[model samples]
Structure formats: C-alpha cells, structure tokens
Target: MAEIIEDFLVKKDQGYYCAYGDFYIDPLYPVQQAVVSHAHGDHASPGHQAIYCTEATAAFMQIRYAKQALSSYQVKDFEQKFHLNGVDILFYPAGHILGSAQILMIYQGVRYLYTGDYKLQEDNTCEPIKIVEADVLITETTFADPNVKHPDPKEEILKLAVASNIMLGCYSLGKAQRITALLNQYLPEKEILVHHSMLAFHRIYDKFNEVPMKYELYNRKSMKGDEKNKVYLIPPLTFNSYRRAKNVLRVFASGWARLQASNDLSLYLSDHVDWEDILTFVKQVKPRAIWTLHGDGRQLHAHLSDDLIIRDIFTQTYRPDFC
Candidate 1:
C-alpha cells in the first residue's frame, strides 16, 4: 500500500517536502519556497527563505518577523497568478485578516484550494471572503461542531456594547476592528479604550483608512478604573486579569468561544464562520476531497460527506501541539 501521506516529492527534477500547507527543499528542508495564506504566525513562518503572500500580509509579516532577510522575500497580491516550476498558483482574500489569502494551486489537471483561516461575514476592515470552486478543498475546521452557530458579527457587537457597562477583551487585530466598527455604527457617542497592541493595529487600520470610529487609544496605565459605558478592546489573554475591574464586563471575540469552554457571560462575540457557515461554504464549493486543519478537525470530518475523503493536518499557530 502507498504511504497515507508522502513527505517528499520529485517534480520537474526538483525535490520538495510537504508539511500541511507549507513546502520546503528536500534534505535541507529550508522552507525556501512558501505560499503563505496569511500573516498569522502559524501559517507564515519567519524561518522561510522565500515567501509569496498578499501585500497586506507582507506588511504584517514585516512587523511579526522583523528582519531584513525575511523582508527580502517576494510578496504577491490577490488574484495574481504566478508559475513556480510548472505549477500555477493564485491568491484570493480569505476574509480572516487585512491581507489573508486562500491559495489556489493548479498542478497538472487538478485544482487545489488551501484555505488559510477564513470567515464569510463581511468586515469593514478588510476585503470580504471570496467563494471559489475547487477540485480539492483544504479548509480550517475551527468551529465545525454542529452545535456551534455564531450570531451575526454586527448584531453581537451592537448587543455587547449596548448591554454592558464595559465591553472588554478580544483579539487585538481583525476581530477588534470589526467590533469597533459595529460599535461605532450602533453606539456612536460611546467612548472606546483599546490596549496598546490594539492601538498599534488600529493605527495600521487607520493608515489604510479602515477605522470606522473616531476614538482614542488607551493603555492599562491610562485606565483610571472609570470604565462605565465604555468599550475596552484587549487581547484574549488579558480577559481573566481584567475581570476585577469595576463596572467592566469581559468579553472575548473568537470562533472558539462558541464551545462550552466559553460559558462565561462576557464572551459572546466571534468573527469566524461557525459550524453552519462551514457547512454552507463546503456545500457551495462542492469539492471532491476535503482536508481539515485548525480547530477540531475530527468533529468537522464526522459531518462531511463520506465521498469527500477527509484528512487532518494541524496548521494552527494558536494551538501548535494539536497535530
């Protein structure tokens, strides 16, 4: 019998190693030629010698990697097709981050789509997710359990802002921007306080003219414990620490929050597509074979069509030990 998976491949007289969505040189396995779907550390490694990504991903990578050698790598834009050896590849917005992409590879006569984490909901800070049909689909199964269903991002944000004295703690980047924009739309007069990390990303968002609210950025030191009727944006890790703040309610925005693990009343926001959304996307793409990555792949695999041949490959930076 053939190996369930092959690590190395010989194509056009060149040897390459495949690990999930990443590819590298043979013996050296230097991770030289990389097609990154997003700037997330799990997907885009700093160790790669050459990188192909969207312009927005390139910018975020510059901040994350912080080295001229890494910055020297090439960056590509969405929908731009390029040929490496004989394989043709293209990038499409994944709707995960400002520069996130879903890589489409055309090798021989087959088309393979590797979805880096994606969301179907519309976010004001970045391009909307584009649905593309493919022969084989490699997608993230982060919230693939049947019981998981997210409230519309816009509605969740508005509800959180209106119900709480302080809306606090979420991912500093993409999710925060989405929340802030929704807050601006529904609670225009409210004050917003963001963590330093969020402020940095917010600055970048503003640079791109993506910020929806005219708000001030604040740090922990600046917070005077007077957070009444204010929305405080913070990193997920900071949620427990700020739980004691007076008149402050802690809320986390992420796809994972839909699970029972997030039973806390403060956490109700999610920017990712839930189980229902995942099924919808899969049904729409209608791929013959589907590979799951990120989140609970096993749960997702159970729900997919038996004919769709499911394979699990862990590609989440947030949970590196998953594989």
Candidate 2:
C-alpha cells in the first residue's frame, strides 16, 4: 500500500514545505518560493519571493494584495506541465472559486495531488473540478463529516423569493460573485446590488464569463422602496457591523449553522464539498492513501474502511499557523 513520503512535503512552522520542489504549497507566511493554490487570503499571502499559479489566480491576488503582491509571478494555464526544482507540476481547476486550483506534483514517478478547497457542486461563476488520479491525495476536509450534507444551492437561492427587500451577507470574493449570478439567473425579478468592495471581484469574474452578470453598486438611494424587489449583497463583516435596518430581511449564505442563526432566514450555501461530495470524489480519484487538512477528520477516519489509509494533517503538531 502507498504511504505518505514524509520527506517529500514536511509540515513546517510556517506551512507545508516540499523539500523535493523547494517550495511551499499555500504557505501561511512569506517564503522564498510559494506554490499558491488560489487567491483566498488564507491560502495566498504577500511578500513571497516568487509565486507559481494560474493567470486568473495571479490577477485575483494582485487585486486583493495590491502593492504587497509578489515580486515575480510564474503564471501558467491549467493542465500545462512545468518543471520546478526537478518536479513536474500542473494546475487543475479546484471548482472552489474563479481561480482556485488543485496543485499536482509528480516526482520520481509518484504523483501527489494537493486539493486546495474543492467542491463537486455546479457553479457557473467558475471552472468546474477536473479530477485526476494520484497515489496520494492531500485534500481539505472543511465539511468531511458524515452528518453534514449541503443542500442544493439553487434551492437555497430560491429562499429569497418571498422577501421583497433582502440583505445577503456573503464573502466579498467568490461567494459574492456566485450569489450575484444565482440571483440574476433564478431570481430575475430581484434587482441585485453589490457592495463596492466586491465590485472589483465581480468585474474580474465578468471578464471570464460568456455573458456579464447584472448588478448595481449598493447605495442608500437604492435601499429605498423605489424598486419592487431588491437584493443587496454585502460582506459578512459589513452585514454584522450594522445595528439595524428598516423593513429588510437579513440573511447570510453559509453552511455553518451559527451564521444562519444570526440572520432572519437560513441560506445554506457553501463553496466547499460536503461529506457526500468528498466521498464521491474519493471514489472517483481512487487514491492509494489520503491526508486531510482544514477541518476535523475524525468522522472520515471512522466511516472509511481500514483498507483505505486516512491521515489527518491538521492535528496538534502539524496544525497551520494561520489558524
């Protein structure tokens, strides 16, 4: 049976270090060489000497970090093979966000796939997941418990149909664009208003979409009852900062129950794969061994049979510094 090559990628104080490639995958702090999996702040950091990622990821990182963006970017297309420190590396679409990627490293004939925040659910705002087989699968277990099953996103989006005036709390980057597209598609009657902070991200995503999304910038004038149905999409922080708003239904879209409890309506929407999706992906990829990060993996270990090797990388010792 295949096992984790400890020396290949060791858990360092900063992040996951690959001695073979001389790089860190989604490092928490600045490093000499970072192979960033996506544009998410937690995964992508500033002050890296050099970054290797997809073109879209580079764009998003630049927009997010501004002046702090990396000095040099070795941007590449998906599925294109590039040699880095004697290892063959390829970026596969992770389906988590617009520029999210699953980094694949092939060294000495053994393949290792690092899945950085992936989902099997259909999302029109970004590229869908492209599953590839590997000897070792290092995946994010954000929702890998047997009890958590994410509801259909389309169905969850429809929950706002009844509320004429709605305030949606979403993450500014990926979640904002997704909710905007869903509102435009399923709830066409609603006038989508995007927060100014998220407008740049929406505009960036628009460049990659076949048809541009429809949204107006959020303003106090629009919040007035001039429009019949209005949905204002704001980031979670902004949503919570408000003390109260008149005649508006407050809702936050997330898989976590705590966020849903704070809002007037529950919208169980998430970009991460649920337990069933994880199981389906595991079956499709047919990995020899599995290593999980990002969340608790005790349930996954207990549910899967002994034939499958399951290891949790985010235990006490190997935990990431960012968290």
Candidate 3:
C-alpha cells in the first residue's frame, strides 16, 4: 500500500502539519508558514510569517484582523496549482463561505485533500464546491451523523413569512451574508437590516456577487416606529445582549439545535455538509482511505465498508500501516 496519511500530514499542537510542505493548515496559533482554508477565526489566525489562501479569504482576514492579519501572504485562485517546499498544492472551492477552499497536496505521487470546512448546498452568497479525487481524503465531520438532515434553506427562510418583525441572530461572517441573500430572494417584501459587524464581510461578498445583497444598517430609528414587515439581522453577540422587545419575534439561523433552543422560531440554515452530502462527496472522491476531524465520526465510521478505512484524527493515534 502507499504510505499512510501520517507520513504526509498529521495533526499537531499547532495544526495539521505537512512535513514535506513545511507548513501548517489552519493552525491553532500563528506559525512560520500557514496554509489557511478560510477566514473563519478558528481556521485562520494572524501574526504568521507567511500565509497562503484564496484572494477572498485574504480579504476577509484583513477585514477581520486588520494590520495584524499577517506579515506576508500569497493568494491563489481555485484549481491553480503551486508548490510549497516541492509539495505540489492547489485549492478547490469548499462552498462554505466566500473564499473557503479544500486544500489538495500531492507528495510522493500520492494526493491528499484537506477539507477545511465544506458544504454541498447551493449558496448564492459564495462559490460552489468542486470535487476532486485523491488517495487520502481528510474531512471535517461536523454533521456526519446519519440522523442530522438539514432542512431546505428556502423552506426554512420562508418560516419568517408569518412574522411582521423578526430579530434574527446569526454569525457575523458567513451566516449573515447567506441569510441576507436568502431574505432578499424569498422575502423581498420585508425590509432587511444588518448589524454593523457584518458590513465588512458583506462588502467583500458583494465584490464577487453578481447581484449585490440588499440590506440596511441596523439603527435605533429603524426599530423605533411600528415598522411592520421588518427583519433585523444581528450577530449572535448582539442578539444575546439584547433584551426582550414587544411584538418582535426572536429567531436564530443555525443548524445546531443548541443555538435554536432560545429562539421563538427556528431556522435550520447551515454552511456545512450533512451526512448524505458527506457520503455523496466520498463517493465522488473515491479515496483509498479516509480520516475525519472537527466532529464525531463514529456514525461515519460505522457506515462505511471495510474496503475504505475511516480514521478519526482526534480519537485515534496514526500509524503508517493503520490503513
């Protein structure tokens, strides 16, 4: 058998390290060279000596971290191949956010694909996912359980039809932009308002969007009058900070059940792939072995056949002959 994934890349205290490439993928803390998958805080950190990612990911990182974003960087387009210490690498769309990408690294003639965070659902706010085959498939099993089936986003967004005024709590980066676009497409009659923190992300998304999202900044005046049919989009921090308001329904847009517990209405919108999507993606990739990360993989492990090895990076130690 070909060399197991451990020889090519393995998880470390800092992040996933590729010894051949001499870089870290989505490191926990800043490192000398970081191959970022996206601009999400957990995936990308500042103060790196050098960085690599797509153009949009870099833009979002700059907007989020400002001057401290990085000391040096290189941006690449989707499917564009480059080399890192002789390790051939390229990016493919992950479809999770504006610049989210699946990093593909080839070393010793074996292909390894690292899915930072990905989704298969149609998201007008960001680029769509592109599938590529690899010998080893490393994936984030965020919603890998068979029972977790995310509802259609269109139907979930339409749940707001009955409410004249809605206060929607969502993440500032990707979620806000997605919900804003959905509201425009599905609930055009309602006036959409956005929180200040998400403006920068929205501006960055607008550059790549064919149809610019329609929204107004959240202001006290916008909430003052009995503004019927108004939807105020606010980040989770602001949403949690707010007090109960009269006649306004509180809703949160997320796939996590915990986040929806306190909401008056539930909107099961998410940017990660569900179990079915994961299986579909796997079939497309046809990897010789599979390694899971980011979430529980027991369900995925039990579901796959013996021909394909499923290793959970967090739960089990890696060995050359493990596969």
Q: List the residue pairs that clash in candidate 2.
A: none
Best of the two (2, 3) by lDDT: 3
CA deviation > 4 Å runs, candidate 3: 69-71, 314-323
TM-score on alpha carbons, each prediction: 0.81, 0.94, 0.94
**lDDT of each structure?**
0.66, 0.86, 0.87
Query: Which pairs of residues collide in candidate 3?
Result: none
* Candidate 2 structure lDDT: 0.86
- Relative to the true structure, candidate 3 has a C-alpha RMSD (angstroms) of 3.4
lDDT for each residue of candidate 3 in 215-287, tens digit (9 for 90 to 100): 8888888977865889998988788887677678899888899988877989999899999999999999999
- Cα lDDT for residue 56, candidate 3: 94
Per-residue CA lDDT of model 2 for 145-194, tens digit only, reads 88899999989999989856888889998999999899899988888999
Model 1 worst lDDT window (10 residues): 6-15
Global fold similarity of model 2 (TM-score):
0.94
lDDT of 1 by residue, 156-231 (tens): 6665645455646677767777677777877786777787777766666777654545667776544555445677
